[model samples]
Target: MSESVVSGLTDLLQRMRQAQREQPHPDASLRRIRLDALAALLRENRPAICEAIDADFGGRPAEETDLLELFPSLQALAHARRHLRRWMKPKRHLAGLWFLPARTLLVPRPLGVVGIIVPWNYPLFLAVGPLVDALAAGNRALVKMSEYTPRFSALFGQLVERYFPQGEVRVVNGDAGVARAFSALPFDHLLFTGSTDVGRHVMRAAAANLTPVTLELGGKSPAIIGPGARFESAVERIVYGKCVNAGQTCIAPDYVLLPRGREADFIATAQRVVARMYPQLATGGQYASIIDDAKHARLIRLRDEAVAGGAQAHALAASSPADAGRVLPPTVLTDTPEDAAVMDEEIFGPLLPLVPYDTLDEALAYVAARPHPLALYLFDNDSAVQRRVEQSQAAGGMCINDTLYHVAQHHLPFGGVGASGLGAYHGEAGFRTFSKMLPVFRQARLNGVGLLNPPYGARFRRMLDLLLRR
Candidate 1:
């Protein structure tokens, strides 16, 4: 790491902190200005944004940029902009019995400067989601775009610079070495979106500075298909979520838990549905690549391991040799062992392994023993079964009949618990993550409660002890 590079970014932060103290509390007008600027930047720079992401991914689909990345970001910004003023208002809190005479209010205050670390998968949404939170909380922020997406990093930096002042918001770009330096900075709050292993490193780094962190980490999320589920609908929803972005989505169904006798039916339906969704396996412009060759190879290795372990593996759609540019077929593996490599790790690709259980209780037990997942999808029409699963299992979020769509609602708070990750941000949840609830107390000018101010007489002490005890 270059000393000069570290020094330059550090100095920028120091100046921003000083400015925050010197400036007055941002009024509603300044908050609106900040959010409006971001909205305009996102709307006007859509083309450059798409191009940069496409360049980074070796020709990512343009519609995906529009539909998945840009559209959701724009909607999030709009939602935040509409509610920013209300969210910034000071909230009134009730005083307890002992403090009934005094009035209390919680003033939401920004923590000066915030740091957001973006991930390679879904870079735009990940970056903008936290950015909206920081802005809505009335704080200046610095964004560190992922180095894996170099083109998006460079282009995002330029767009941010054009829309925001260097002191207000700046995008920093570098390799992993630079990322380490960035995480080490003492930001007031830091939000990271990435793999679970990297999340631990970020949390440890933030701990040194006593910085608050919100980690949106990914684990082996599961989708369970009960015996009573509508097979066709379940297949359609699962395939749609998993096949999107070549299954690079953090919330994509990692593997599945199916009833013992239903594995064959599920696999057969999945094959038909996936084929319908992606007519051309390799060259279809609607189909996305596996991000990079390394990810492609990793999925292949997992497939090989599962097959060698006696799991039934099938690549339903066969692709031509010439069209193999980081493309993996939508695959379904059945009867995988609990200890197999596919079950042990997060399958962040289009490989869906089916682990069959004789009973639903067994499936719940298996998921409970594993690390808490970011999301869980259960396909069952039985209310009793859904309630039992909800009460027994712990996850960041759960969808009743679908996969990954829980994160899309924008009305619910999204985050992981335990090892999946910590903290949450989306809609109002984002505003709260960035703002501190500073409680203020107001008291009457009368000195009615000053009996023991200076002289601690026996009478005063006795009264205090009796009152506290009672």
Candidate 2:
């Protein structure tokens, strides 16, 4: 890392540590003020924020940014504001009869300075979502923006400085080397949102300091279309999920599992849905472009490799004149081999693979064989099937007859399972993740512990026996 970047990071961490030490437990009023300021930062710079993301992605749709990034950020802030007081209140627990005059309380306190690493996709929401929780939990935070999205990262850094004090919340803009150094900082807590491979490195870096971490990693999240499902509805929802943000979302349906003999029908329906959603893929501004040339090339290579392995690649829209834009037309792959590159890795783009299954058991087994995904989707009305999937399958979150909406519900705790991720953060779960729940036990003046205290004797044995029996 550059000397200037190292020096700046050191200074920022020291400032945050000092600020947190001075106010270990911020009152609800102060937390609300911080949240209000954050909301203002996002609200006042809405246009610039959208434009910067658009510039970064080459052509990111403004509406998509609003829907995917700005809306959730505002909602998270609003939810935290609404329940901050209750979340901050300590929970009282009654003591056992043996300790009649004692009381136990669980108090939530800040975890000092926190480090947040944001990914390029959904840059704004990922950054602010965790910020809401960190601020609600009364911790100073330093966010490291992804190097891939330079325009948005730089703009967000500027906005953070404009709205927040350097001590309370700061933004870091740098390359991968700086990110490595930032992750190694001895913060009280660290939260990283990105791919699983990188998550391992972040965990290793955090381990040197023994810092607690919340990893929001991604995997090959699957969408299963059950035999009893509404076929057209399932395809439509999956299309919406896959096409939005050009299927760059971490939790977007990476692939699909459909009943045997329905592959052709599903593909046709998905194509129709895509066409209707974006009448002109080449020129439509509604459809977001790939983040950059490298990502676009990667997606193309995955598709080409799958085709070379004997898979059938079908473009959603008819071919158009060649262009230099980063947009890759939504494509669906059928007959993809198990060993195909697209099937092996998390396809973080607009390419979707359709896997046919003979039975629900086979579908469930297929998912089981892979790492637990961040999100799983099922389109079945049967309560029995839902129950079976709920009990059998392991995933961070699920949606019945829907997709992508589960993460938006503030009441739900969002995170991955196993390789998908380690910890969850959303709503109150998020607040608790950032805060340390310190348990306090208070002993009253009048207690019956004297009988059990002191050297071993007949009285102590008798008292122990009575308590044990009780």
Candidate 3:
């Protein structure tokens, strides 16, 4: 960490903190304005934002960016804007029997200053998604953009300064060294979205300040094809999830669990789906290239290691060469060893591995044994199987008969569990995550009795007896 980076971040954080102290809680109207500005920021610079991300990724379609990244961000902002009053209004609770003449309510108070550490994969969405919550909670924020997406990160830093006022929010652009220093700042709350390994470092750094963290870390999220799953439909959904963003998405299915006898069906179906979705991985606009050469090489190494360990690699889009355009064709690996790097690590690329299971119990056992994943996909239409699997297997979020759609739901809170990540933030969940919900109790002028005083007399004894009896 450079002294300049540390000093700069410290200075900025101090300014934001002082600004938050001035107005601990912004009114609903002010929050509405902030939300509108965020939406406008996206709308006004949609093309530039998309282009920067595309350039950073080498080749990511702008339309895909609109649908996947822009849509959810805008929709979530609208949701917050529409429901800001209801969310901000203090929630009342009935007084307990012991305190009959008192009132209890939960008043959400801003946590002062918030820190959002954005990842490169979905820089725009990740940054704005949490910013929506922090602003709605009426807290000033300082965001740390990922170094991997330099083009978009720098652009966002400049664009945000133009839209938002000085102290309300500021986007900081820096590399890993700067990120290390930024994480150490004493913000009231910090939300980090990235790998589990890096999450540990962030948490440790934030620990010095005792900052509350909401970590959206991605682990090996699994997709299980249940015995009664809608066969073709399930494969189609999983293919789309894995191939989108060239499988760079955090919640994209890391691997698939299928019945031992159905490997061929999955391969055939996946091939047809991939070919249809991206007719020419060689030149197709819908098909996204790998984020960069290093990521591309890493995916190949994972695949090659899996194959060397006795797995069979079946290229879904055999006609279109992956290396030709930095676009890795969707490849499904079967007979993958338990210790293969692809299976062991979170595969954040266009490599899909299928694990065969003899029974549902075995499949559930397999998933249960591993670290809790960020997301889980179940392709079962049977209500009983869905309930059993979902109940037994613990994941941050889940999608039934589909994939990746769960994260897009504004109604649902999205986050990970255990190793995958910690805490959640989206919509109302996001609002609450960034708030400190202060508990307030008011006593009526005329209460029950002043019998239970420090003086231990007959009346105090009697009052205590009555209370104990009740």
Candidate 4:
């Protein structure tokens, strides 16, 4: 880590901390103003933000960026703004008869300064979504953008500085070393979104300061095609979810579980769906390219390794020449070994693996054996099967007969489980995550509790007995 970068981040943290101390609680009007500023920032720079993301990714589709990043971000902001006052209000609690004239209230207070570390994938949504909660909860924040997406990072940083004061919300752009130093800073709370391996490092860094962390990490999220599922509908939705961002999404279905002897049928349906979705791979405007050559190559290698391990590889779209672009046509692998790299790691790309199972129990068992994923998809109309699978399996979130839509619902809490992630943030849950719920109890001068505070006496004994009986 560069000394200058560390010093700069430390200075920024000090400023925010000082500001938070000055105003520990921001009024609802001020919070709404900050949220409105964020909305305006997005509204005014919509085109520029899309272009910056497209430039960062060699050929990220503008429409995909809008649908996945911009839309969700604005939705989160709007939700927060609409409910800011209610969320900030102290919740009242009932006081017992014995404690008459006493009041109990739960107050939500800001956590001073918060640090948010965003990942490259869905950069805008991840950054903006968390910022909405942090700001709504009345905390000053510092965001660290991924170095991989240099164009978007720099553009976003400039926009934040232009729209908001540095003491309120600041954006920091740096490489891994800078990220390491940034994570080490003592903040009231830290939220990191990325892979599990790196989440460990972030947690370790935050540990020095004893900063509470909310890690939105990724894992091999699986999609199961129930035996009674509508095959065509399930395949279509899965294809759309997988290909939207070229399967780079953290909650994207990394693999599929199909009934025994149905692997071929599922693959054929996937191919047809992909073909219809992207008529042209080389120049199709709808299909997004991999973020860069390294990621593209990693996906290819995963497919190749699965093939070399005796798995059948099927390309959904026509193979474009390597020189054409960084687009790696969606490929499906079948009969992959359990120990294959693609199966072991969270395939954060377009490569999908199919695992056939003899029974639904087998499918559920397979999922249970691995680390809990961030999301799980089940395609079936049968309430019994849905209930069975939902109850038996453990994941951060679940969508029945759908994919990737759960995270978009502002009412739902989104995060991970075990290796997938820790702590959730969305809607009111997000506000709570960023805020501290302080319980306050006020006693009136005429309260009866004084009777029990003195030495052990007959009146105290009688009062205690009456309370215990109640």
Best by TM-score: 2
State each model's C-alpha RMSD to the native. Answer: 1.8, 1.0, 1.2, 1.2
Cα lDDT listed for each candidate: 0.84, 0.92, 0.91, 0.92
Global lDDT for candidate 3? Answer: 0.91
Pick the lDDT winner: 2
Task: Provide the lowest-lDDT 10-residue window in model 4.
Answer: 320-329
Off by over 4 Å in 2: none
Local lDDT at 446 for model 2: 87
**Candidates by lDDT, descending order:** 2, 4, 3, 1
lDDT of 3 by residue, 292-370 (tens): 7788888889999999999999999864554466878889999898889988999998889999999999999999999
Off by over 4 Å in 4: none
lDDT of 4 by residue, 1-470 (tens): 76888898999899999999999999998999899999999999999999999988888888988999999999999999888889889999768787878989999999999999999988899999999999999999999999989999999999999999769999998889999999999999999999999999999999999999999998999999998999999999888888888899999999999888988888899889987889987687678888888888888888889899989998899887757688878888988988899999999888899999899889899999999999999999999999998889999999999999999999899999999999999999999999999999988777677788989899889988999998
In candidate 2 the C-alpha lDDT for residue 289 amounts to: 88
What residue pairs are clashing in model 4? none
In the predicted model 2, the residue pairs found to clash are: none
Q: Tell me which of candidates 3 and 4 scores higher on lDDT.
A: 4
Instruction: Tell me the lDDT of model 3 at 259.
Output: 93
Q: Tens-digit lDDT track for model 1 on 272-384?
A: 88778778767776777777778778888998888888888877677535645777778888877767888888888888988888888898998999999999999999999
lDDT (Cα, 0-100) at 149 in candidate 1 = 92
Q: Please provide, for model 2 over 382-469, each residue's C-alpha lDDT reduced to its tens digit, 9 standing for 90 to 100.
A: 9999999999999999999999999999878999999999999989999999999999999988888788788989989888898889
